[model samples]
Target chain A: MAINDNNTDSNKSQKQEEKDLPKVVIFLPPPVFSLIGEESFASNKFLFLKAYDSQLPLLQFLSTHSKSIKAILSSGGAAVNADILQLLPEVGLVVTTSAGLNQIDIPECRRRGIKIANAGNVYSDDVADLAVGLLIDVLRKVSASDRYVRQGFWATKGDYPLGSKLGGKRVGIVGLGNIGREVAKRLEAFGCFVSYNSRKKKPYVSYPFYQNVCELAANCDALIICCGLSDETHHMINKQVLSALGKEGVIVNVGRGPIIDEKEMLRCLVQGEIAGAGLDVFENEPDVPKEFFALDNVVLSPHRAVFTPESEKNLSQLVVGNLEAFLSNKPLLSEYVD
Target chain B: MAINDNNTDSNKSQKQEEKDLPKVVIFLPPPVFSLIGEESFASNKFLFLKAYDSQLPLLQFLSTHSKSIKAILSSGGAAVNADILQLLPEVGLVVTTSAGLNQIDIPECRRRGIKIANAGNVYSDDVADLAVGLLIDVLRKVSASDRYVRQGFWATKGDYPLGSKLGGKRVGIVGLGNIGREVAKRLEAFGCFVSYNSRKKKPYVSYPFYQNVCELAANCDALIICCGLSDETHHMINKQVLSALGKEGVIVNVGRGPIIDEKEMLRCLVQGEIAGAGLDVFENEPDVPKEFFALDNVVLSPHRAVFTPESEKNLSQLVVGNLEAFLSNKPLLSEYVD
Candidate 1:
């Protein structure tokens, strides 16, 4: 009986020591963590102090725990700007569960000497899969035919209109990065000829390079945008590029939507200036142009190109890895060096 | 004036000679000819007799033209069985503008020593493209997600359900014929591991062979039915096989529908025994089960797998090539030797 009581006390002390270890803070839990279940992170090295549970306001909660919170796990919805960063003076690192860091203030993080880790190539395959999937859906009219079948139109209207074939089409990939390269690989298997337009030609890439987006659009049957959004690339696919793509051309975008001039592209699609489009991201997401819903030549997705179950699992592993690396002062798994 | 009269008389004689060329009879003009325009075939060597305009019963029409009609050009809906063949004893060749010969009585054609040509391999690429398209649509939920966005569900519901990823999935192709091989190639580009079950182990193939479909289903994450419908293959994917595929399994059918037990498959899908399905061909096409319309896990297409514009062009060329070969007594371009 005495040995059992001593063992119970030691276990409680060990649990207390674990609770005293370094803390990682999350305001609003990321979708990945919630989807995978919060219990999965229960056995990790550090403690996760959820600010949402605090009775105080966010700024007040942060100021109260400023001395204890050493790391922040930011998600797409939570903006990690200078104001938030200034509240946690002891915070040394911020890890995001998304491929893009547009929500995080990068220059501010750098000036404050705080390190950042992103989702890296964890989502590249899923994003590329959706891009190619959207391309095939548009070219083959998969979703439109689905509508035809569901509406009982096939029996009433006879044979559906023939769709264009996928093989042997000329496809130009804008921004031939990780996602673009994967799209190119899959397209090559379908017998499509691949070319590219990037800020700089990739040294190891074998696909044809075009310096101008208009020139690339002119030579290809479809343009797939995979480049990140920045000031220079915003509206890169303008009216000139869409016009150069011609009336028989197609456009697919899995990257940020502002990279394309959405208004000009919509005008082209409406007037039959372009053949079709497959869009997963829009300039203003969740507020898609109502005009697009009436068109048969376009496929609209709900900006979920990177949210597969497999990708979510990968993202969870990456988040844990980044947090572990940050706690130990090791190199971050997917540090945003730029 | 004398020279002009002489040339007109010679042209009349040449016209008569042209009419004496070997005859090719078409009861109903094929859609390919109508699509490409009948003028495209006007310059060919053989003379096509329009039986539809004869103002006679089909049998009587064939009886009257039996001596002139050397070949019959049959489309998908046209039947070239023993009765039609007996009406025209002089007809030695039958050319069909479809891949499947289910419409023609193949055994009777063999018994009558009638040579046959089909639209061989012309639509293989297109069919394979659709198979892969449907698979991606199912795994990634492209059509369903498209519907969600179009119906304003994304704006109201916040986020759509996460779909399964395509990479690293173990896929079993039911048949390793032309279209199956193409499906394997494209899936490999996406990093999926492939195996197959076929009528016989192909000598030149390197993929692992499973003699039993149930075993294959047990081993793979998805099953793609690409085999033709025959007595032996009818209802091959029965209840036992579906059970072996388990709850996370997906099934994609680009093959004929009765290859699967449609009722059992529906039950499994409804009961959540299988994850999802993507069907292009159905047991009763153009009359899909009304129950499927309510299910979000399945993608319904109206049997347009091989009807791409490019494939139609290839089919036209094959038809012309077979007819020309038969007229000149050369080997048929796509002869159905069996």
Candidate 2:
């Protein structure tokens, strides 16, 4: 070797020497974004992994990658299964932008020691606002009014069915979390009596707290769901709850879809089991059952409770901040421990 | 006289039955009877006028058939113009359900001392509720959003523009009477700061008080018209006030239509002088200006602010009570003094 060849050899040796860097693989579901989804910088920073027909490609890529992949972020109704969690690169965190972690295999994440964080309190107010709007919409027959107005029946719509005003109604909340508290505040302003049912009664709130959903349903003129979804909560609002609501009851859901049994709800609505219902999240999203379309007493919005550009921007920024913190070995803003 | 023949020799039937009992004729507007019109009871009790029209045939018959008819009552929007007021019996009390005395020429009523009483403050809450609803509807773009959902736009509508939430907004009220106070209360619950301009500042209220409409408009993000309609107040919200509101302002009218300069409002709305408007009452009724139908920024509700059945029942009962009080030599529950 000549004198310059010695320097070249030294440069190659330095270049080959490297330390392990943490890798992040984000699984983004189809239609995960909204108008302002780009505002979430952290979510945008991760390497995107779309779930194709199979996770084989994902597993293959992760196994061969040299960087120590440590985290996975998924959004939308799409969930990460147990098998997928097993295939995930040795990671320390798996975060989701959902209030509920039903879709995530929590038990598997626990077994693997993967920390899980979710967008919990972040969307409470947004969902509560939708709940109130939906309640007002369905009870006031706003959809029918719109149809009547558009069809030029303005003059002949006849004495509009008077709606029970919000002033003197009893409202029951399924959960007493951030969303429930927000809803309680709003309903209190309207002079409604707000009661709540949770796993256990919260001592701090002034609302009448109950430990049973059926008891709450029996007492409240209207029922609103603002709880998380889980095996214990699955089909929690079943036939018994529906029957307890009686014929004059109004039900509004802004929580997970599986919390209420869709088939039972449909049957009750068909049989006039209850007065009306307002649903933001459904059993199946864009794939809403045809039965819902034909009902005049139901107000259905396609899982748009967490929409609104302001919230989206806020949530995105938070998500990005968390991602930055996680990658830097710093504490996440909302780190989750399985 | 024949029934009293035994004692007829004493008095010649008491001067021919008390001079024909002052033959009364009442000219009622169409369909004025059946407790529908606000003046039906007063017209019926006086027995001074005939109900001619089918809607008010009894009052017309009384007006036409009675020879010594000294009074008449007409209801609905049929104005007691100078011409019509002059044709009424000399001793007449012209009453109206509306707060405004314009339908009956005030000068004429004063000239004749016709003792007119209007159903004032009867629709204050209803009107105030509608004004607030209209404000929200316009600010929130409720109708537009409804259309967006119904039109299948969903999330594809390109964000739908982040609307200014009702919380933490300044609302300027043009009056501080029953309706205005109610509006202030409702807005207060929404986290809005309320200010008002009335005949005089109400120191009792905690809200900031302005002495002029222009000043109120200048300080407020939204200006609401709730003041009484009068010659002094007609066109109170003129170009100067509209200009004071600048470009990004909202106007809501639940007061009489003339209080706002309809022509100026049209020009401003067309030229983007204001952000949006909600108009329940108009300078003219039923026959709104064709241009009104063309504006997308304004909401029209067919002057139905007091259209709720609850309000209707309250109004009718109040009107009947006022009549009963008048007939029984008692003070009216709510008397209007001019």
Candidate 3:
């Protein structure tokens, strides 16, 4: 008895349909894909070609299939720069699974006429929740007290030294974008006085804005860095800014690591020049300074400000939606305009 | 040479004045005194008689100066029971340097016609700050991730598991009291959907009210216990409540520990019946279940939700104010009327 040719033909065409799908080369899998998984993107109109799966080297693989690459998916884990773009001359777009553009070469993408799509406003709530969490952790000593309890210090030693209160605190937010505004809203409910320092003062905002970050740091009890990492903002919180913040001041950074001078901040923390710090990002990720480990006044996280399950789901849908929109010649869901 | 007898006389007079001042017996100093020293109260018109200073025991010290004992300064550290009150025949007032009356015997004091003053509404902001902090810690894995980073897991292991989002979560406040209201206000800014369970439905309030704790837990993604420890509230959160809360639910207790049946909660956590817990108060405090120490999902803290440098300062004034008012025949500042 011969097997039905109909089933065989259907299977062949299914394979053909999957093979014919337009390619979006993933030179690097985003941290988001690690969270929500890339399985959802497979249901879309595009086929993701994972460059790492090829036995050939990254450059050789990119050059071997240059004609097939119409888009590049990037993140903080991978840099989509001029060299990578040079190999993929047919690439028309670059999509980043991150809120910031620091990982990707924006000027190069612009000069090459490549449209960029990013995770816009999808992670605002998650980042804001973590910003407030870190602030409270630093000021209220949540994690420090947790350590005390876990180590059985409460039974042996006693209550840890009292932490400062968040209420009535003057909190200055640097780079008051979506994440900053969300943080300000949460802090306001905690009865904190909110102020902001952006490159230029935002119109229609009620908060008191300072043109200078140092002035903002000087006046506020705490400074929360929510700015992007760029040439202007890199090491923005230098020694002078930290000195102006004074000994009783606290800082919470959910933004990029290098935005604050890490070495200067470490010295200030060690010397009691600043009261405490809560950092979600580091100057060099996965290579945090060992100095931060012993400090009770600091709460360190593994740069997970935007990795909540809800945000991850939202990001997965957004990433797939942006790629599908691009493949269908539709406007990007979250286009990154310079 | 004859020294000035006038200088000696002035010193003698000052000593006499201090000796003649009314004495308020301090049997056991509250934790507040640990944060802010007792020196502030020494400046008052009345002299605080430190019972621990005498060679005699607490009871003997109280009886030796019954005539001088018109008031007792008490705290969570010492219970103001009928045993202690019976020693002071003239004691008409009991002042606690804590927010809750669980540390004091209210019925015994009420029967003897003794007035009670507490740190009313003073620690509300501090407790609320910590309640939100613990909620954030449990939901966002703040303390867990802190440990992960502290143990240098991020370097060896890439990223910790994603935590749940606080926004759009149904947060059930167990008590609609001052601290609960404050917590609700803060969670609202984080975009949480708020409901409550109080003894009586509050008028002019808009949140959904569940009279049953189990029902509240059933509907909420998280439960924040902010009620006091009372006859009706003892072990209010039992096995049934934890079961109703299910596997996705989290809990935070800034209230007295006995409010939740800890053994049942522990079983639920161990069995994965409930997601996680953040506990500041325990049933047998300073002796937390060793099982909790090993659980990454739980964030343990000493009973310090009501403490902060700012709150301690406010409490110092309030404690002294209530005592001064009692001595001066003015109304008690924060009288706990039965």
Candidate 4:
């Protein structure tokens, strides 16, 4: 009877341990579309609250249940600023439902010994497709001509400058990652010969690999930025790179804005340093300089290269999957070393 | 000596005729990119003048040399409205660089007994490529998302939605002409099942032929508009047609704008009557309602689908060649019979 009682207690303890698993406080920084049908977290048992605001409120809420709060999931355009990271000292993990890790301070996470993982490569295909789309949009001047016809200017004495074709053009890819490779494959379909530059030549890739960006630019008709942003790559596309691209060449940036020298790019575009530019990202976003808006040759967007319904879902699945894997003690799919 | 004198006079008359050559008056509308380059018409002795702007000036100039105007070549997007046709009574022939005759009044030409020919099949490849590009852009949400990422909203919460892959999708092309045939071939490379709807079932076309638009839409996942704008095809994509396309279907219009009902289309989109639309032409252009301006579900462009540098130059060559053939009493490549 005593042995049976001990076995019963062991079973109960196992159930209790499963119920008491470290809580994951997912901070809902904003309302998701059709959230009414979404599943809610079980109360007092690994509770997940919807903040729909800043990390300060999240931190304030987490501080109240500090003992059970082992991890935090944050969302929205706002990044994990310094204030929130400093507040959550006991937090073991900070997960983001985004592919970019720029907003999350990796150095601070490293210093605090807290694990930081991002939903990287989830939107690679979506972004790559758009990069090619933007390039085509600019090269063909699709939007500009569309405006011309819609405005009844066809009846006037104006000319829609003939657009260049995409086929048989040399396309230089600055980065050879998932997005870059995808772009290469798609461009290849259109008869574009693709050449790329990366930190090192990838053995798995069969396309022509260049040792440097300038060499790639000099040989190609279009120089596309698909590389990541970092201190080393900050303003990498300076006057030198523009000169290498030449007057007949075009530059299309689908990567981070800091990777290009905005001031230099504008000067080059205005002075015909390069033929034209199709920019999706900017050095300072949502506040593009007045100079950029005035240019007709350049095709400028508000930096929304990966905003799609498919990409959104793909990224969410990756983030949620990573969280599930971490909780289950399986290795994270896209773990950030920092 | 008398025989020599007569031969000399005949030679002089021949030379005079060659020098005159009727001063073939050509009217080019707006948007003809290369404008029948220098060597193209100069060697043939055509006085090239654009009729897109200030038709009064062109009319006055043409009237002065009306007896010399044996032929007229119009290459631009400028419409040869009914008013323009009344002035061409003395003009022996009218040649257009584009295949579309919607802008030219065929009844007026028949009444005046003027021979008419147009450059056909020159822009089929160009138009087909743009149609598929629009389809991919809509299915993938290419432009909208590119707008989102470039705007620096990626660091924020949520993922873009997942898009349907084009591979294995059923594509119904509503014309088996040069453009539709080319589109089907391109879709084949993408692993898509191609079907077509034409006036008469094309015997040589390998793709399955659907006799009706409703039948084609019901069978296919996507529909492409590549037909001509005629009495039979006006408002072809009305509410009933779209209803047959199903709620998850996509429509890509590279054809004339009048074929689709703008009011009905907006209603269909608002009520989720169809999944999405990629329109290169609209029922009433340049005045795309404010409703379409903000939707990510639709992509709008001015009707410049047949635009490309190579195509423009090719079209010019075709126009010149058509003139040469007609002058030599040879059958035209693309003759319009009233």
Candidate 5:
């Protein structure tokens, strides 16, 4: 009789179901939850604790599962703020499926002595590959040429306009981090001279560093933004920098949206203030300026730089691996270091 | 009065005007003529002789001015055949702006002891750059993503499907010539391990060489056709090799059309027997199979791989340099050997 009542399931109290759950729960929110849904939607998916979408307030929910919540899985869109971190005393690890730790409160986690594991260099290759792809698309007109062919213009029109060359051109890389270095490596292979603008000069690196981004823009034929989005880097590629880049310069952004001033960039690209642009991210994502729709010089890619079937599968493994390492009291697979 | 008479020139004979021309004249044809017009169209453009577009037959034209026509400027769409070469016995040099010498009668020119100058490695970088561009465009879905963003589908239609990764991909190049080697160089920089199926194994190269194209297709994640169009290579990438490439394989063609079996490839791509293709050259370019227009996996590029502003400028210089060398009784800038 009791089994029959429980089997109906509408009678199963939320508190009772919560009580029956095991310890060491991993919390998932918006982006990570959806990503996990893509691959881990099949079976045994009950392992992930999804409390972010619950009826209770975030802090209240966190407080309720405070003891059992051993780790937090984070990614784009949702910020793992300090208050949320503070509520979970047992939360020893924060695993983000993103290579960039912009959404995570790094300072708060550092203060708490809670370890953070990120996607690390797993996404670096894919992101850098896209950056190079966009660069070639812009400089060599890959996307435009594709459009021309797809539209049956090749048969009707005489030729697509000539594109700029990659070789012998000066290319400036922003951030000079893992992704930037990867871009530099690939661009160098294409015979482009790679200089960079980082927060500070990296030691043992041969690329000429410019402290001021404007100076970097003025010197380079193309500027590829690979820096993470932070207050210091927000709108770092502004009107002044774009102007310095001049009419012959192209800019490729694989970094976050706000890293460049999209309004100014749009105007610059439309007016031919800059030669062209290859943009993956915009000021407001999924709402790329409609002005870019018809521009042949601009190659607009919806923020998909870090995505590839292989990379996402790799990321899932990495996310699971990081959480497993934390639970087993083993070293983190990809511990984030500032 | 005498200047006016010459300036009007109504009574001037064609032979009289031809008599005014120089003893040694370089020829101009369709593709080369148009390409030369792109760069050298300013003032002294009358230097290059015009004969290919004349009312006279090619042989009659060559025979009429055999001694005067010292050099032939060749390019795509026009063939420098045995009869034309035989008629112009005094044609001391043949300068082709194309790196591939397939259009020119090599054996006939060799027997006549006429030196040949071609665009050597000037186009290799641009062609290789485009090959890599198309490769990344296909594998990373660069062009498709661009379309998604451009069409406002990203905001409404949700995320674009994930693309295959370039990193750790086993890429097989059909030809290990200058462009193929350069493509290999660029792909290696992107973390793609490159192998090749050339006419024969290249000396001093470390990469694995596949004697059989089917074996190469079987082993690789992607295949890039860079071989010249000739008897041995025409339709070489047929059903068997494409089938060996499997369902997950991608192919890129920067070589001339007809190197791959176009109809079979269209079938493979439509049926998903092969993953996708990035085609810069189609069997009948400017008239690509209309079926390819609707395929998201296929990135159709209007055969602009060898044409970039900088590369074309470089080519013009090389063409002029080769012609100048021939006229001055000096060694050619890019003398063809075989």
Candidate 6:
């Protein structure tokens, strides 16, 4: 009750100060903002109005602050659909603390002439680090062998099985975007030959490109998925593609789960059709297949490829920069024009 | 009885043909030769006479064939001591299927004017690969996070804890030998700053060298031990060095275990003085401390850093090459002059 009373007093003071500051509405608080310590974002130039904190419904909350709220802060999980956009007629800019903008209705924002800013290549290094980490884990059996050592099997079982060497492996990267490029750079140091499959061959990239996913999988020892999920990309890693990867091949998925057909890939892994997989995302997140728990070859992560503390700090800075730029009528730091 | 009778017939034929070929005495059959397939080493130029296969005792077996044995093939576990050398007065060369020459008495061999050949850099790349693998596994908590996921903690517990990034980490190599140099090369590709501590400063190397190991531990975020076990290096990584490494420093040992003070290191790890460790060797392998099984931060490997199929094949080739060179009086292929 004492805390509630203090919050009410602060709310009253905030209302009084709202007229002097630029108001920015946040649909849902990103995990990074909370992690980096909220006090770091305290600024006199802009006021962050959290829509989730309001007692009223989201639509009602937007209607109440529509005239004053000119910029919106959103995230990957929060929907920035046309319905919410229509409620805030004065909102001129939308800033997201995520690299992917699939949740946002880009066409609607374009029609309304609302500029969009995203956490661009800020997370590329972190995501790429995880992708390579997972690849090495799968290939070298780092996690499985650790389990063997932890379970007191090393002393009793004698020698642990030999792992395949990382050097001289042919790795095919799916989607040679920022994250994919970073992954390629790291793996190249291990002596792995890198090739890629993308929508179109990148202008400056000299890595061999395969237009078809199956062709890429067939030619390489492993495939790392780093592309975004879309109607065209959904279930792109299907049964045929998994078959192409073959019995001695590996697959590491750091991209959106729907980009791969999770059910088929699971069957392939269970049946030993493919050697192994290291997955950070699933078709339905936090609902991994039970079969994966029993499999030693596969390593499962709970969608944490982009959740390092350093990268989170970078994302927080980008979010603040975008908000500040939009308020002062300057160009957005990471504006996504398309 | 039938198998023994067949072996006797083969032994008689082997004795008959032994005089026609150059006789090479083997102290023991190395695991690499067996792994590479015994048929691969079958040659008419030199007949390998396994000392263990002789029905007589070792000394009697050596005395019976001493004059015929001009070259001796030994390994890490099989000692080529002064007694064995004195028995085989004709042994002018000692070929080892291991990189380290600790098992062979170097002074006695030099006094007898006998040449030595070792596995050389055949296993260096494989050992370096495991060192990097262990480092990545420890820093990223790859094995620990995998255990969390396997135990179904991801769904119930939500997001796993974030891992530290590999880039920008200061890694100090304990030795600047072939294996150590390979580790530095791979880590450099990950954007890690490499430094080193060696017996003497390597002239051509540019990385900062620390003559004192305690000074090296104090400056580096991680220490990778890659030196051989010797009188000077025994218990080199003692309490003072581990303390200097501090709370967040990681230690990876691909070298001999006695190089680190196992008892003190364990106490420090248990007490949270040092962050974590990745160990491929132990003070007494096949008898690891029970306490290590319970620690999630430590990754234990069963002394398998140098064992890989590719490296095993390379070792097989080197062993054959050394034997052929010794017989032809052409310099021994991986001759260890020191």
Summed backbone clashes in each candidate are 0, 33, 0, 31, 0, 0
TM-score for predicted model 3 compared with the true structure:
0.95
Model 3 over residues B36-103: C-alpha lDDT tens digits?
78776555468888887789988888889989878988887787888988989888888888888887
DockQ of 4: 0.20
TM-score of chain A of each: 0.92, 0.86, 0.95, 0.81, 0.88, 0.92
- Write model 5 residue lDDT over B17-117, tens digit each, in one string: 65654333334553544654744522222246667557887667777877777778777767888877777777878888787788888888888888988
Docking quality band of candidate 2, CAPRI definitions? incorrect
Best by DockQ: 3
Using TM-score, give the best candidate's number.
3
In order, the B-chain TM-scores come to 0.89, 0.79, 0.95, 0.84, 0.89, 0.93
Model 4: per-residue lDDT, tens digit, B1-338? 35788899998997786666654555654345455454544435444444444447766765555566667776535565557656656666788766577767677777777788876877887787678777877776655554454343544633445455565689999977878887887677555799989889888678898998889999989999998888888998888889999888999999888888878888888788898888887776545676776666777766667877767777767776777777667787677663
Name the candidate that leads on lDDT: 3
Interface RMSD of each: 0.8, 4.4, 0.8, 4.7, 1.0, 1.5
User: What stretches of model 5 exceed 4 Å from their correct place?
Assistant: A1-47, B1-47
Q: What is the DockQ of each candidate?
A: 0.79, 0.16, 0.80, 0.20, 0.74, 0.63
lDDT of 6: 0.86
Candidate 4 residues A216-270, lDDT tens each? 8889999889987867678888888888999888998988888999999889889
- Return whichever of 3 and 5 wins on DockQ: 3
lDDT of 2 by residue, B1-338 (tens): 25576576556765565455543333444222332543534433343334453364443543444345544343555566666655555544555556556656778777876666666776676676667667765665554454444445554453344444565679999988888887887677556789999988886788998988898999999998888787889999999999999788999998888999999988999999998888867786544566765565776665555554445555666665665555556776766665
Candidate 1 chain A: worst 10 consecutive residues by lDDT?
A: A35-44
Model 3 C-alpha lDDT versus the unseen true structure: 0.90
Two-chain DockQ for model 5? 0.74
Worst 10 residues of 3 chain B by lDDT: B36-45
Q: For model 4, what is the alpha-carbon lDDT of residue B2?
A: 50
Model 6 lDDT tens row, A151-206: 78987886677777778899999999888999999888778999999999889899
- Candidate 1's clash total is 0
User: Between 1 and 5, whose lDDT is larger?
Assistant: 1
